[model samples]
Target chain A: MDEDAKAVATALARESAADGLRRLTDLLLRVADDDPGLAAIAQELDRITEELDQITEELDQITEELDRITEELGASDDGRRPVGVDPVAGRANACAPPLEVWCLPDGTAGASGSLGITYQGPRGLVHGGVSALILDHVLNVALSEQGPAAAGGELSVRYHRPLPLYRNFLATGRLSRGADGELRAVGEITVAGVVAVSAARIVGGRGVRM
Target chain B: MDEDAKAVATALARESAADGLRRLTDLLLRVADDDPGLAAIAQELDRITEELDQITEELDQITEELDRITEELGASDDGRRPVGVDPVAGRANACAPPLEVWCLPDGTAGASGSLGITYQGPRGLVHGGVSALILDHVLNVALSEQGPAAAGGELSVRYHRPLPLYRNFLATGRLSRGADGELRAVGEITVAGVVAVSAARIVGGRGVRM
Candidate 1:
């Protein structure tokens, strides 16, 4: 199992043990007034309580480690905008993408984007629909270089992957081919560069802006 | 002007006239105590208000007539979906499309799609960005069908029309051509069958579900 899973499991075991000890203490207290072995039972109960204290400490350590792991996972896959580049073309200096995005230099009109808190979807995690919105934005903006134009005449995206909540992600869009008045663009949204969603669009001449 | 536009204009005029009368009433009230001579002026104001009322009533009647015209204009349109029907193969339903999609007896894709509330982009009217989203959705879906069966790959869409808000809209997607495991799609979004958004997509075979 993964480190996080292991930590979680350890924490659960320790907590359960602690709870069991507390239950034993409660049973001992309830019978102490009537049982002739009350004194012995009281001694055993003291030992169990001491053990529960140790278990509680161990569980606390595991919970802290699990929190760190969760943060690391979230940062690695959260998809909003990219890092080290301007989120907007000319306004990069003025507006950084709410998330981080990476601009690829492969001449394929490629860009990777990341998202963060301002773009929350689910209560604590990103919403699935918001993930699609981010993909659409990344793909549409990535095609801005084809002819100094930015807009979508058509777009189609499918949820091939489940976008998680509050996680770092990656989104990439590329211009595939172009001819006459038509151009083709494609993109993918990923978690830590793993494809979570795939999409495509057909764009034509600079028509009236919608 | 189109019927919808005309209706809008007439309604605006009537609203303006009513507002004018109300303003005049306030003006006369303010002047009543300041100058006895203003009583004469109030008579003139009354006459002007009566004239405005007449114009307002006439415009209201015209607006009602125009409303019918606008409804008719919005109801019928020339947009269709094209799916080749194979009578013996039971593939005729393939040609059926989303509601409001126009179709010819022949299986050729139409050039327009109607706009609806789901396409809203802004607060009240259809948002330009949302309009683009709709166009993209249609083109990408159409391209998916025309491209390789396993070609459910990445795609992109471009917006070429200003899809107006609060008006009946039409949209279309056309498969221009496909080659080398790559395919091209093109189409336009229209308002009342008038072009509002244009799009294109380049698709390939990879992650396509269909």
Candidate 2:
């Protein structure tokens, strides 16, 4: 097919998918009505939900696999040093790792990273809570590096802007002493170098082995 | 088997599992080192990770099945009942309806009642981010109740305590007036009459419906 034809086909597919999604949302909003008709609608939407979930899983697998390949290529280009990521220790910490843990020098006290995911709402982007999770991880790392009393006691995340889900994200965290003998930590997730989520935490209490 | 024998067997199984888990954690922590024997260990951990993923999927399925059964029971208890629930419609809207939308009467809100999940943590149980989510949903319902505003603005969620994940929960949300041209909304999630999560937000901007 010609390039124009291909573009038309892609546009049509996108339009159809958007319409289907809109219909599904409408059905869910109507679910509270308890109409007998919903039994059929529910079954139909359940199938759609399962399919969408499957697609999401496939996409995640693809993304992660691609990331692995990219990391391998990047490593090879950089003289084949193994990526220095530390496997996540436990759930007491955030669900993922910091970007600097494997890439930076041991004394590298401060570095920033970001998370880009589909489920975020602002900027039609990653949710603020998700951003907070990233901040927690980043700040936790900062605390861990700064010595004892840096784990995490209280975290305050302020949403400065809606983080768009598009790629090229960044998060940076830093640790400093607060007035009450606690470590004050601040972090931010940025998109295209713009601050989206800003967070502060007074990190104190028992330190866990990260 | 005798009661004592059964108890002994259970204890033995628990001890073995704990030992195995500790061994696995130890192996995972040491995976990155360049040991000749690390390949076998990596294979074993890969198998374990796959098994854990399967277990998580099975548990999620079982939970969904249980929710379905409970929902079916709620429906059969009354023939005239509507289905599902809408927290804003008030009690005047319900008739023990199956899947009925009932406006949760204000002041009775709690964690389990609305979130459909156990409130997990303050950073307050339910995680500050989850609180924001629940509160955002509650506020969304309130927006539906209140006529559209000219411009809505910030959402602030205050964590009073760690929201405990409990069997049953409730939450109440109110949309009220604030100082100058801003709408004030408050939400609280509770468990067995104890407050778990509370949130407040200002709504603004034309949300692009995607």
Candidate 3:
């Protein structure tokens, strides 16, 4: 498939807009630059923001309705209904670098995405928290369906080396049952085939590692 | 100060554009809506992408120069130079919720921000990894000057309860010296006066918690 089509298939929804959001993020990082092209973007954004402000003000009339609809969607009796936007791998979430996830034959979950300056942490590296975000999402995805409710557990992250920006990275995960009978999802972020950050999401009760 | 000026001052730089980027995010979440107003944003983004495509193509000319400048900025004898964008709290970083951080008289580091659907995690709540992101950034910020190099060690996060969206939350951190002489930054996320997540950043060598 074409790249556009692929992005469309990849994102859960609003792929064009989300891609645009990503580009906007990239451009904003250069805003401090003295470039005239960058200034044009600043002006364009002013117009867009003005337009959005007006629409949103009118949108306030339907605010209650939207909230009601959102509530109905989130109205799970079990209190675990997903809020639809996954901050790391969920395509629809603009906050996400939105990794593309797939599976290996052994059921290991795999995700791939290129880190940019937007995910920048200290200086040229991806944020430690961003790595945690990716691993947490990918491991949970790799876990069998048995562990959805176990998603909100403690995450232990060991930063072996700083993950860098503007590099394509792969994150892979597999589920293992701990000795204490709790399920654990373990994963790593690899740049150019080397592990940079390794993590494990311990589901439920702070159980021991597998 | 007025709200706009306050946002400007609170942000280290590029406050207007970052805030605009954020509003764009809020608008994108509602792209699923059939509202005529929402359609305008989609159309506007299409125009934006076209314009950006042109500018970025020109930007490719300076790509090397930008990279050179970025390299100069990132160039440090030691490998720990910060990349200048903080994903959770850095005002200049569009990816950040861009929390406002300040120091308490007692040397506690404090951060305040309201998360939105963009940072949404599992259904109807903040992403688990996001809490880790906030705590990680805040803790690193909180630790006294002794621990900058120790920032990337390890982060342990325990989710006491789900941190909700569209609500204001505060994360606070303080430095604690471990018995082994390693430093640890301890902090928590509190919403409406309730602790939803607690975290500790173990600075180096896998030191025990203080």
Top candidate (TM-score): 3
Candidate 2 lDDT over A152-200, as tens digits, reads 2445556566666435566776766655565565667777778766666
Write candidate 3's Cα lDDT for B25-87 as tens digits: 554464343333333444443444454344334334334444444455443212332223467
- lDDT of each residue in B66-132, candidate 1, tens digit only: 3443343342112121121110011111111112443333323443333322232322333343444
Q: After superposition, how far is residue B29 of candidate 3 from its true place, in Å?
A: 1.2
Which 10 residues in a row give candidate 3 chain B its minimum summed lDDT?
Answer: B75-84
Task: Identify the candidate with maximal lDDT.
Answer: 3
Looking at model 2, residue B158 earns an lDDT score of 46
Which candidate would rank higher by TM-score, 2 or 3?
3
Chain A TM-score from candidate 3: 0.68
Candidate 3 similarity to native, TM-score: 0.71
Worst 10 residues of 2 chain A by lDDT: A85-94
Per-residue C-alpha lDDT of model 1 across residues A117-169, encoded as one tens digit per residue: 22222223333334444555565556766556444355656555456644666
Model 2, B1-210: lDDT tens digits are 554454343334322322222222222222222333324344443444444344335434533553454365453323332222121222211100011122444522222343211122221123344445545545555654665521234444444555543234565667666556455556666667776555555566221110
Write down the C-alpha DockQ for each prediction. Answer: 0.04, 0.04, 0.27
Model 1 ranges with Cα > 4 A deviation: A1-97, A101-105, A108-129, A150-152, A178-182, A205-210, B1-129, B132-160, B164-210
- lDDT (Cα atoms) of all candidates against the true structure: 0.39, 0.40, 0.63
Query: What's the i-RMS of each model?
Result: 31.2, 16.4, 7.5
